[model samples]
Target: MDKLKPFPAVPSDGKIETIPFLKACRSVVKLLETFGPVLMPAVDDIHGNVKKLEKIYMENQTEFKYLNGMLLEEKRKMGCHARIALLWLRRGLELFFVLFSKVVEQHAAGKVLQDLRPLIKQAYEETLEKFHGYRTKQMCMGLMEKFRKYKDFLQIMGANDERSESSVFTILPVYLDGIKCSTEAIYNRMVKKNQVEKHIDDAETEKTLTQRELDKIKVEELQMLQTEEKKASQDQCI
Candidate 1:
């Protein structure tokens, strides 16, 4: 939880460290702010879940060394607080991460539309639509009616200058991939492969990105933007 805003690194056991897991989630809640106030409801829910888990973890530090461990123990003891808390937290992270990834992808392609409801709707459908009850889903759609301009959003994400903007975007996907990995590691332990496939297309989303694939994405995005900028510059020159 420093200036780097690093995602929690899952330990070698692939079990999420309790304190770090909570910190990482708080980081995601912070990221949600860049989207503007339209997502305040989601931001609130995610932040609340983090607090829920943190409170329970604080109850017994040694007992809850790892998040997955806490859930497994709850299952064994036939209790549900930790289980339910983590479940909601995981679900919230998936919804937001999926949405953020799509936003970054659109921006990488050199397009950030003035109205982004379509993107918002798509993310909602993919992640949280089926899970929510009718009223919740309706509220979600209503929120989609508004969105922040991309330039202003990027400014909040710390795009102070040309060089810094590039740095911000580069760091974004890496953070996304890190969250993707940590969350998946926790989820894959509990959910079946088929269940995961239902969330993201294996071929499209890669299930998990290797460092090489991550680098490829960054390179491709930068090359695409650079090419577009150069072409526009040439046209203006002509």
Candidate 2:
């Protein structure tokens, strides 16, 4: 019989290169940061429009009561005259337009907010998944290292001892559990860091409304208020 050729020895110094998923993750994170601020104005604008509509609706309700009171007093004094017709026409149009405008504005705002919701959720999930993926890769690398070391130790301990196999079987589960625990801890830390970073970013951006933008919003609001007041006063006069 031919002599059995010895198998080539495995290189002990072989190095495995880890996947660079973290670099891709960092790029995604940077993208999220850049686009996140761009979306904020749209969000804030929608919110402001909603609040403005609500305020206008409430004001219209109050004005409706006042108009009704005025109409009642006019009817009592005038005693069934055509002046009531003009009064109702003017006041009624004002109230109708106010309600109509509020409805229209609110509808528009709701549509914009709805469109943004999906984008926000996607960005959040992408960041979360990337973080999880990085942690998993790290844990896998650590487990592989432990596996290599354990195998080497077992080889050095020799093949005849049944106790070594038994010990390995018992300890393997613990090693796996430790890796799992480590992954969980890393995942939790990443999540906490994301949350804290988000909080800080939100806080910093909260006061980022530019003076020009704020002034423009204020002017538009004042113009609307003035227009409404003028219309109401004109109705009361006639």
Candidate 3:
């Protein structure tokens, strides 16, 4: 626990170094390992997604040096897996941050671990609830029922003492900021690159789409039509 380092602040250029960011995530996984069976799923998700990003970095260390660069390169190559991994990884980090921030809030208010179980549930609702299917959400709630005892839990996380608590309290805010900044930087880049996939609702779909969205939809529809026409022309010769 003492060796666990908080993620470094985003660099001056706002480019998160891939290796360093992944190293910080490794620390996140190490800490979550303290939660036993309750967080094993999250542990697995983080480990898996980290590997996805790490694989790309290993394949092209220089080109994939920064997170945004990796996203752009992968997206340019139509390699969507790394981008998807990033989406889930960001969500998992968000969940971890929310849960720990809530715990810190409760602790500051003189609350103990017994009082934190519901807070943990609330954190899930705030972070990962929307993304999780009904069954997975239920499984998460069920696992909450087996949460460990207060002192035992604290001991595992090294939060039992004033010094350790202070360490977390001091580090949590900056860590949260780092995650938000880095993820946001990459997400914005994806959107600018037209790599973000989102559904736009129109009166046709019984949903409302903005003017920009309406134009974007028309462009995509035209592109699809062109593709089909090209394919039909090729089939005629065969």
Give the per-residue lDDT of model 2 (tens digit) for 38-75: 33322232233333333333544543232233223433
Give Cα distance to truth, residue 212, candidate 3, Å: 26
* lDDT (C-alpha, whole model) for all candidates: 0.66, 0.31, 0.67
Winner on lDDT (2 vs 3): 3
Residue 160 C-alpha lDDT in model 1:
76
Candidate number with greatest TM-score: 3
* lDDT score, candidate 1: 0.66
TM-score of 2: 0.18
Q: 1-238 in candidate 3: lDDT tens per residue?
A: 5556556567566677888888888888888888776776567667778998998888889888887787667434544456556666766777777877776677778865664578667877886667666777788899877767666656776778888867766766666677677666656654323433343111123124556765565466446446756888999989
Regions more than 4 Å wrong, model 2:
1-160, 191-238
Q: Write the per-residue lDDT of candidate 1 for residues 94-180, one digit (tens) a residue.
A: 777787788788878998456666776787788667666677777777877777666666577788788887888788888888878
The lowest-lDDT stretch of 10 consecutive residues in candidate 3 is 198-207
Candidate with better TM-score, 1 vs 3: 3
lDDT of 2 at 68: 30
What's each prediction's clash count?
Answer: 0, 0, 1
RMSD of each: 17.2, 30.9, 10.3
